[model samples]
Target: MILITGTAGFIGFHLSQRLLRDGEEVVGLDVINDYYDINVKYSRLAEAGIDKNEIEYGKLVQSTTQPGYRFIKLDLTDRESLNQLFEAEKFATVVNLAAQAGVRYSLINPQAYIDSNIIGFTNILEACRHHVVKHLAYASSSSVYGLNEKMPLSTGDNVDHPISLYAASKKSNELMAHTYSHLFGLATTGLRFFTVYGPWGRPDMALFLFTEAILKGEPIKVFNHGNMVRDFTYVDDIVEGIKRVIENPPKGNPEWTGESPDPSTSKAPYKVYNIGNNDPVTLMDFILAIEEELGQKAEKNMMDLQPGDVPATYADVQDLMDDLGYKPETHIRHGIRNFLDWYREYYGYVTDQGADAGAITDQKKQ
Candidate 1:
């Protein structure tokens, strides 16, 4: 059986849907916390045709129409339950996607990262070790490349300096996973994702926030005085990459040496790859995409960069492509349009081509 955490999340939801459509049996787990909107999470579950029977506290139960998907709302931090779940399920492959995911929010509640990302990941590693799971794939972040000014951020590059607590926690995860792989021979792969965005995405993310605010006639805050850049990746491509990588578990690098080691691979059944579009999008261009999708102009209140924020992020996807044949093709304009369509339908927002982005006037050029 294939087990997935954060199955209700954006990437997780899309992945579960894809796997179920392909007739794969999937067992999903999530804590269902009120971090953003529990209703949206539940709605995503319902859309998956999950039965709400046998519900537990803070948990949602789902049985799929595809007859191959099941979801259980459970916290990764609960070690006892996590172990029992792992023991009971006998999952051959485990995708660890659950984490308190936010860069800025990490500055406020740093403990959340420790509990979820660190402690919870530790439990997952131990469970894999004890249960004899063949492979484990977990979500790392491009944030791990913190404070690095390098262009086309490569997984092979050193990721020692991190600017945010979130980045530090992700880096810590890579270290922990390497140690586990070395000691227990568990096949592990860490993906450092850059600015993933698409339909049914997180509310806190830039695309979602920008689309919502612009549609509502509110000024979307353009950070770094409109100088930032991001390797904005589509969720669909990420899920596709993941499905392929899970089947091809990592083998220890024979050429790896302790003196001159590669950060991307280890002698111990461990690997890390950068999953991104590899095309950097300037902040101003991104704003223009939303403006075109909404068919409205945004009132621009250009501001200095925020703390724990990087000026730009560009991913080096050569290793990913050469290894897994992964290619991300969704252009930002198309992705933005898809998201806006979903937003209007899902949220009952009025659809109008004349609708304008709030207060901040733009140097409107798409």
Candidate 2:
């Protein structure tokens, strides 16, 4: 059996749907916290044939649409509950995608990071160790590459300087995974994802925010004064990479020595890979793509870089290609177009309403 955490999340929801469609038995878990919009989370679950009204917290309920899928509302930090579920389910593979995600939000609520990213991840590692799970795959982030002036960030690069608490938490996850892999013989793979965006995505992300703002006739906040670049990856591509990594757990490298250790792979059955489009697009170009898709130009309010925000991000996926024989192949225009299509259809945005985002923001503040 496969256990997927954060099933209500953007990536996790898509991944679970794909696995279920492939006729795999999947058990999904999530807390369904109200980080952004609870309705969106519920909508994703509804798409998966799991009705919100039918859900009972911490109880496994079978999906009405997909015969091979079940879902449980649970938090990772609840060690007792997690262990009990692990013991009962005997999951062969565990994919953890749950965490309090946000770079700037980490600055405001530092303890939330420790609770979810650190403590929760520790619980997952412990559960895997005890349950004898075959493989464990968890989401890391490109933000871990903070302060590195290198282009096309590679897993081989050392990530010592993290400008944000969120980045630090992700880096800590890697260290924790390595220790478990070394001592307990658990096979773990960490994926450092770069700017994942697509249909049914989080409202807090750039694509969703920008599309919403542009459609509403509001000025989109162009961070870094339109100088920032991102290796924007599509959700489907990331899910594909994750499936490949999960199916092929790494074997310990016999030649790996302490003399000159490779950061990507270890003597233990642990591996890390950069899962991204590898094509960096400037913020201006990204906004223009959104504008083109909506057939409306945004009122650009050029802004300086916010705290804990990086100016650029690029991924080196050579290792991913060599090992998995696949790389992310989605183009920016096509991806953005798809997102716009979905956004319009899902939100009933048939025509431009010219709703100003500035007005909405002001009202929220009031």
Q: Over 4 Å off in model 1, which ranges?
A: 52-54, 57-64, 351-366
Q: How accurate is candidate 1 locally (lDDT)?
A: 0.85
Clashes of 1: 8
Q: What count of clashes does model 2 give?
A: 1
- lDDT tens per residue, model 1, 321-359: 898888787898888888887877676554453345321
Model 2 scores worst on lDDT over the 10 consecutive residues at 357-366
Note the residue pairs that clash in candidate 1: 51-63, 217-358, 218-358, 298-360, 299-360, 299-361, 300-360, 300-361
lDDT, candidate 2, 230-349, per-residue tens: 999999999999999999998888988989989889999999999999999999989888888778889989899999999999999999999999999899999988888787667655
Q: Specify the highest-lDDT model's number.
A: 2
* Residue 100, candidate 1: C-alpha displacement in angstroms: 0.6
Worst 10 residues of 1 by lDDT: 357-366
